[model samples]
Target: MHYVTSKTLLSSNNGMNLYRGCTHGCIYCDSRSECYNMNHDFEDIEVKQNSAELLKKELLKRPKSMVGTGSMTDPYIPIEKNLKYVRKSLEMIYRYGFGFTCITKSDLVLRDLDLLEKINERSKAVVQMTLTTADDDLCSILEPNVCVTSRRVEVLKTLSEAGIPTVVWLCPILPYINDSHENINGILDFCIESGVHGIICFGMGLTLREGNREYFYKKLDENFPGLREKYVEKFGDSYTVSSPNNRELMKIFKKRTDEKGILNDNDEIFRYLHNFPQDSVQTKLI
Candidate 1:
């Protein structure tokens, strides 16, 4: 909800965050980790006033690469409906002949379908959506501030029908909450039906750190009631906090994705994302 001028945009690897912090209110958000120092409140949403101009300048100077966003914050948050920074950035990427990709939980991405399709037709554009649980009720609890799982699946289907490739982040499966065979199967089924090109799952468990860990535990106490004590007894200041069902859940994940020909490997997906197609006609203009 605040604006500040940004000196630069785009990282060495061609990523940019148009906004710092987030309003998504996802209970397991890692961006809140103390490792990433944010001077503002998590929900305040610091807008980079000069992001569009800065991105245009950087795009002109850099080699054609896949430009990405929504790493630290969801670019399609509610504020995006009015700010429209993400849409502006997409236009610049398309105009510059750069491939585009982003990680988001909002269905509002559909609003920029025209630009995304144009960029994909010229080069490449991948829409990466996160689907943690198939149950809409659980999704509401875990990612309270964004769209539900079924609606996101619909967005994926719409994008696929438009001939745009899509990817899904199936991650941070909380133990004793969503780490069930039924829950995992439901989510995987949704991915397969949506025609997602890949699923990035680190494991069946979520990670906890200083800032995020405290916030997650607080929410657990409020919602799950005494789940915090169980986490302490089980993890007790550990970083990874992997699920006991990780092995079995991963078995199911790999088998399903492999059968469906959807990628289950993180490195493979990363390569797919970072590899910018050089066939773009716009590349010649630049």
Candidate 2:
């Protein structure tokens, strides 16, 4: 973990990545891709030492809107236990009356449940969790370093009970691995039980770019021997690796989400996430 003074925090889209790299060690992490051109090791974790102040600066001048993170990297990695950068930023977001959202796989998010509930009451706070597979054993093999699917589900339920909305990211369905009806159904069942507001799944596949592809193949060889050769023979440098059962699997996904009335359309979900309730804004000062 290293700290550097950053000139800015929020992106043009209003997202802020307080930490640049991650320590959760998910094998299929797209952030490791060379296209990102990260200057240091993926585990080094660049910290914006001034994130709270920087974010406050922007939040003060800007009109109320949603502020998000966890697109480029997970903010609740182990080091966050002590750093508390995410917690600090959330305090500021609440102080300035901006909505909040995040994508993470760790149960540590529950530690901020108090702040999340407070923000939801004042404005909005939506937590988006990644659930790639339902089976804990397979989840261990795929995500490796983070909490399992069951634990994430529990967190989602807890958040929902607190009146904070939650979303699930069902993605990177490794072909020939987790692309089964049983796996999809198991995950959707968890979502329904957790009462998630939406589930974002872009087909039944994962993207494999240059940097992440190599790393993913290495992990596959170590865990599922001969899997790398199979992927190479099939995908062969393609960026989007769709599963053979994409059509069928998507049918199951849509049917389950539709029946439950969960948001299935990506655009609608994103719009919901970004569209702050106009009436929720107020002059809450720190």
Candidate 3:
């Protein structure tokens, strides 16, 4: 909830984060890792007060491309209800004739459905949502601050109905916790039913670095009792924590997504996301 004047908005890759840090109390947030090096508390939320203006300048200078956000933090956190920086930035992106994409887990995205649809019509607008667990109660524990999985599915359906392509991030499977076929199948079923364009799942595992590792372990100790000790015994300090069922679960993920004609390959989905349609550029020129 703090604002600071920022020098720039978009990265060389055309990605922009309207806010830094997050309020979404996800126990397994990799952004909390020390490698990112945020100066303030994770919940403090650094705001780029002049992001809209900076984005306008950047967009006017560059050719039409897909501008993405919410990689480092969710732009639709509760603070967004009052700040509305994301909404303002969307207006700027649309006004400048650039494509837009975002990764979010909150139903708050529904509030901006009008603008997303408009951008899709003019260029392209893809909504990428992360669905870690299908169980609502488990979802609440894993991602405490955002909307549940079912609600996120509804948001995806609504976006699809609006003609906006949707992508799902099925990740951080939290080995030994949600690495079950039932959870994977449940989430994939939701994706198929919602008609998602793709699903990105690296594997049935979660990574833990220094900062996030401590936080995750602490949460496990608090909630799951002896689970922290079990993790320590199994994976002393390894960064990548893959599940025993990673191979099997991946098979299910690939089979389901492939059968439904949904994009499951990470590279393909990223290429699709970063690609700016030629028609959009042509329309901009016209």
Per TM-score, the best of the predicted structures is 2
- Best-to-worst TM-score order: 2, 1, 3
Could you tally the backbone clashes for each prediction?
A: 0, 0, 0
- Candidate 1, residue 219: lDDT: 92
lDDT of each: 0.91, 0.92, 0.91
The digit string of per-residue lDDT tens for model 1 on 99-161 reads: 999999998999999999999999999999999998999889999989999999999999999
Clashing pairs in 3: none
What stretches of model 1 exceed 4 Å from their correct place? 283-286
TM-score of each: 0.98, 0.98, 0.97
Error of 3 at 234 (Å): 0.9
Model 1 global lDDT (CA atoms, 0 to 1): 0.91
